[model samples]
Target: MFIFVILGLLVCTEAQGISAGTPVFVLKGEDLLLNVTKAVVLGKFDDFSWKCNKSNIVRFTFNDKGASPHYTGRIEFPENNFSVKLKNLQEADSGVYTAVVMKDSGDETEAKYSVKVQDRASLPLLTVSSVSESSSSCSFTVTCSSQDSHINSTFTCDTRTCSQEGGERSEGIPDTFLQVYQSSGSIICNHSNHVSWTNDTNTIKDVCHQQDDPEGLSVCLVKTCVFSVGLIIMVSAVITVHLMEKLNKNK
Candidate 1:
């Protein structure tokens, strides 16, 4: 029993009573195309399926579909090819596609397609909340969080932990002091490739003013000004009273 195959560009297995088949390997997040150049007779395949493998992983499958009867005509590739769709696949989906050919002449041809999957980076994140304006006397807290993580690692993180900082990561509470000259109300935050950042790119579009001081709304600044003015008035009054007492005592 011999199997003869018609492959393009490569001719190596063409001997009588010889049956040969090979396996194809593709990477993750990728597609692959395969064709039988050699003639595989009908009536030989009992079972055919796909299987994927990774570390600490074993055989895997995609579609457990059988054939459509032997050789009504050979299925051409690329136009309706099986190999072209194996590109840019996922790591969990990487595996082997086994094709079993049962020949009427008591011969069998077995072929396989092996694939490897890759990782793709996802979009970033954005959040807006409170800042120094939340309170005039108390502290205000604002935080940004991202959704990306290292797919293959173990981690423990606080609000500021990132994938690049292996193992456990903790972020310290930060308090940034800024002059509240105006009410800057808008915030922009971004999360990209497992990283997070923020800014006031909205140009502080809308800052509501206090009813008492419509022109200047920052209570922190107003309080400081009131304290300074009161101190100055008290000092001036004390100096004038002391001068009057001295003049009266001299007379």
Candidate 2:
């Protein structure tokens, strides 16, 4: 049975005569719509069928034979329509899908598709590697990490923009891509796939501390001054008390 199924797929793939639009990217676990042009004369065609990865997914016949049992209840075929709707898609469902319309005259109309199931890109991470300042400008080196932590890329940012320097891409990660953009004083690192995208942003002033210092420096300075004043007051009071006691004892 498996051998026959594989052979059937091979035959269908080879028999696929016409192709449609570019590959469709669909989010995993969502419904997918595989479109096929509606036959002009609904009564002329004897059977309309759909296949995924060359496996018979559903079929509709003029005789009311119904769809294939494998996709029963999970698939929808509107009356007189060649399009198909698949629900609760999984990664396994990602593949080439074909639709074939067979007419009473023995003619067939076909269309092919390459469907990809992807998940929305997760949030990425941005890290600062180093910051250097000059009289004129500040330069910063930053790293962006993929959502899955599989790919790490380094980029350099000047006053204007951020550009990629180097990176390592790991195998077996699906639908991974990296992008960097700088706007105003902010640098954004974006990670995406065909289905979705996510990004992390950092401001130039925060990373490089371009001015006198970061806001945190003011707080540190305040704390240091308070501590020094408290210490000096305590020492002065102790010395004054000691000298008064000595003078009284001498008297």
Candidate 2 lDDT, 1-251, residue by residue in tens: 99999999988876563354247888988998777765533464466778787678887676664666777777876545667789888878888888766675774646677888887787888777667666445666666777465444454544444465555433236667876656666777788888888889987767654333433355567889999999999999999999999999999
Query: Compared with the true structure, what per-residue lDDT tens digits does model 1 show for residues 1-251?
Result: 13343452135443321232243333333455544344432323332222233121111123333223321132223432122223334545545544443333452434454443333322323222342332222112223333332111121212221121121222322211111111223333322221222322222323212222334355787889999999999999999999999999999
Give the total clashing residue pairs for model 2.
Answer: 0
Which ranges of candidate 2 are over 4 A from the true structure? 1-21, 40-45, 103-107, 147-174, 211-251
Residue 176 lDDT in model 2?
A: 71
Which regions of candidate 1 fall more than 4 Å away from where they truly are?
1-27, 43-88, 103-107, 120-251
10 residues in a row with least lDDT, candidate 1 = 173-182
- Highest TM-score scorer: 2
RMSD (Cα, Å) of candidate 1?
17.8
RMSD of each: 17.8, 12.1
